[model samples]
Target: MTLFRQIYALLFVLFLLIVASIAYVQFTETQSFLSKQMESDINNASHSLGLMLVPALEAGDDVATETLVNVLFEGGYYQQITLTWLVDGKQQVWTNDIRVTGVPQWFIDLNLFKPITKENVITSGWLQLAKLEITAHPGFGYHEMWRIISNIIIVFSILFLIAILFARVGLGMILKPLNSLSEHAQKIAKRQFGPDMPTPKTTELKELVRAFNSMSAQLKQVFSSLDEEVSALRKKNLVDHVSNLPNRQYMVSRINGWLSEPSSGALMLIKMDWLEDVHSQYGYQIRDETIKLLAEQLHQQLDEISPSVIARIAAYEFAVLIEESERDLLTRYLQCLIRTTNKEISKAGCKPNERFNIGIAERLGQMTVTDILAQADNALQRSRQDNKVFHWFENSQQQLFSREDWRVKLTEAINDKQFQFRWQPVMQLENTEVSQRELFCQLSIQDNMLHAGQFMPFVEMLSLGAMLDRCLIETVAKHNLFERNLEPIAINLTFQSISDQDFHVWLKQFLQNHSTPERVCFEIPEASVYSDLLSCEKICHIIRECGAKFGIDHFGRQFGSMTYLQNLRPSYVKLDQSFAFIEENQHNSELCRALVNVAKGLDIEVIVTGIQEQEQLARFSELRLDAYQGFIAPPEEIKLG
Candidate 1:
């Protein structure tokens, strides 16, 4: 029981005992006084009656004596009265037997007031006439005692109720401080350091709250310092000091990470031929300033194209990675870059063509980082030899479908529902059990099956993500995936779907109709979340309201602030595939460890992806992740019933 309840109960019992004791004392004292009064009244009455009856006894008037005794008996105060003649030895007795009235039988049975009898000798001119005896009725005593006791009980009951009500209110006020302290402690457990609690009026509680607030402030500071240190380390190792862009190391890591997935993009290398000339003519300062200015212009132009990375790979060479395979879009962006760079060159008092050369390489089937880099370098050499402003690396491979053909194929697939579902299980490290299954869908066209990576870019490019997501949700629900198994199914949501209000409404209805909403988890990429945090947060709220779950995919890929994790607070986060290479470099290891600490501190589960080998799993095990997902085991293709 709560402390307030226990204290209240004890007080109530004590109050009852006190009232009972007072009632008992009052009852007994009233009974004693009534008994004494009854004895005195009976004695006086016996003497008065004996004297009054002397005339009748002297004249030997039996009728008058009987009348006087009968009158006294009818008064209801005396229980019995007797008068006897002593001279003749033939007793003349006037006896009256009466019952007590004006009181309950139970109260009379208590015998609180005992019956009082008195005897007296009657004298007439020095002659003993008769003896008189009178017994007092206990009815009046019982009636008077009952009234007094009843009044005492009624008054004490009122007082007892008032005392109990006041005691409960007072106890609640006194313990309010402890309740506040408990809530503060729970926040601390979640690593959420909110504002300090107000000090309580009680001295001990006030001190306790003050100490707790101090600890919370200290903890917040410690976490802030750790985050700052990690940020500084990342900047020093992966960022270019002059251009403030990602350095060569960071670019290479990102390229490898992208290549691990079935994705397509292009890489452009910009060679600044005039940097060396400027350095010799003016100074290193002016040359650095020119590079910085060029970097700023590039950022301004390419900032709109997301999933793109700009890096200063060499002292005089800069690289831009764009995750776009559409030739027209690529060409438009390239033209804009050329115009922007030429403008900067004129401002620096240099000829645009003589100042730089550009090389472009398109990502093709199953290409590695080295393959793309080599292709771009060959293109650069060709551009310089041809004395051209830019050159493109040609590939013999052709696309599987044209833009129109892809549109037609995807539309047909969606309409006809020609999609196959597959899932890979994420295993918990401690128990080696399936935590959840990451869902994947493939388009079955003719005799070929294409994975999401092969066609998802087109889906987003065509703005058909909302349609695709709706279809997938309906398919999954129709199959009753949750009822078939206990494990939750994690579905990756598109930026387009999450940003669409109609899609949100549809999702809400779908989840509501499903019997087990908890078994559905919607995941969004980290890049998409950072791109539109408010939209993502809204969708997450909707999902939670429907009793489903939300998670973040490729969690540590973006360079945005980690503060969003505190606000969104997803159920779990899947680390970017790049973290699988942690065993390759010290910087990678430290970055992974720091990211793990940040997420785990917030009570968020961290899962590492791309675990293809035992050694990778062993290395990540040191980080104490909740689960892992990769090719350690092949993905199982789920057949729909």
Candidate 2:
């Protein structure tokens, strides 16, 4: 039982014992007092009546004697009265049966007041005329005793109830601090460090609350310190000091993540051949300033385009990866960046022609990081050889659909409800149990089965992400996937859907209709969360409120703070796929370990994706990961029920 209940119960029993003791004492004292008072009254009555009857006895008038005795007996106070004739040795008796009114038989049976008898001699001057005996009725004494005891009981009964109420309130007040401490501990368990608990009036509880607050503050500081350490490590290793852009290692990992997906993008490599000359002429400070300025300009220009990465790969070479599938827009952005770089270089006293040579390589089907880098390097060579500012790496392969064609295909797929979902099981490392299944949606268009990586970009580009997400949820519900598998299915939410308020409302209603909301898990990309934290937080709140789970996808891909995990508190986080190649990349391995630590400290599950080999799993195992999803357990088509 809770402390409050236990204390309350003990107090209740104590109160009951006190009331009983008081009642017992009152009953015994009242009974004794009534018995003594009855005895005194009877004795006084016997004496007075004997004196009054003396004259009648002296006159030898039996009628007068009988009349006096009858008067006393008929009064009902006396149970029996007798007049004895000493002269003639004869006796006359006047008696009445005892009867008590307005008292229970049980009280009478208790015999609280016993019958009292008193005797006196009737005297004429110096001699007694006749002996008089009177017995007092116990009925009156019994009635009086009952009345006093009943009143005491009634009064004390009410006092006991009032005392109980006061005790409950008092106990609640006394334990309030303990309750607050308990709640605070629960929050800490969830890795939420809230405000300090109020100090209580009780000395011991006051000390305890202070101690708890100190512990909570320390815990918060520890988590903050861990996050700071991770951030410092990231900056030290993955970030370039001169340009403040991502270093070469970071870019390679990011490009590898992109290449793993069945998507198309462009990598532009810029070689600053004149940077060496500038360093020799203008010193390190000017060269560093020039690089910083050029990096800032590049960031500003590329911010308007889709998500891209700008990195300082080498001392004189920088790379930019843009996810723009359109050739014309890519070319426009590249030209704009080149012009901006030329102006920065000219202002820094370098010839425009010697400033840089640009290489452009299109990210196409099944390309590795080396393949794309070598292609871009070849393009850079051609640009230097032809004396051109930029050159595109030539490819004979063509895209399956134009931008408009993709829009059309996505629209048709959504309208026709032709999106197919595959389930990839995520196994818990502890038990090898399927913790959840990550859902991957595919599009069926013109005899082609397109993976989510292929068409999702178009869905996002066309602003159909919300529509597609809604369709996918409905399909999952219709097929009763939750019932069939008896495990949660995590659905990936697009950035557009995460930001759409209407989609949030629809999702709330949909989950309300779906009885088993716990069977669904909504995953929002870490990139989306970085883009608009408020929107992501709102959606995450809604999802959790509806009894479903929320997780972060591509958790460590973005260069944002890990502190957001403390607020969003997702059920789990799938580390970006780039971390899957940790066996070959020690940088990724250390970064992954740091990310996992920060997340696990908050009690959030850490899941690594793209675990294709046992070695990758073995490497990640040291990090205490919860689960993983990749080709190790390939995605299976969820059969419709």
Best by TM-score: 2
- Estimate every model's Cα lDDT from 0 to 1: 0.83, 0.84
What are the candidates' C-alpha RMSDs? 3.7, 3.2
Off by over 4 Å in 1: 3-154, 261-264, 305-307, 364-367, 396-417, 505-513, 542-547
For candidate 2, list the clashing residue pairs, or say none: 122-128, 122-129, 123-128
lDDT of 2 at 56: 84
Q: Which residue runs does candidate 2 get wrong by more than 4 Å?
A: 56-67, 74-111, 117-135, 161-176, 195-202, 262-264, 324-332, 394-409, 582-588
lDDT of 1 by residue, 224-247 (tens): 766776687678777899988888
TM-score of 1: 0.87
Query: How high is each candidate's TM-score?
Result: 0.87, 0.89
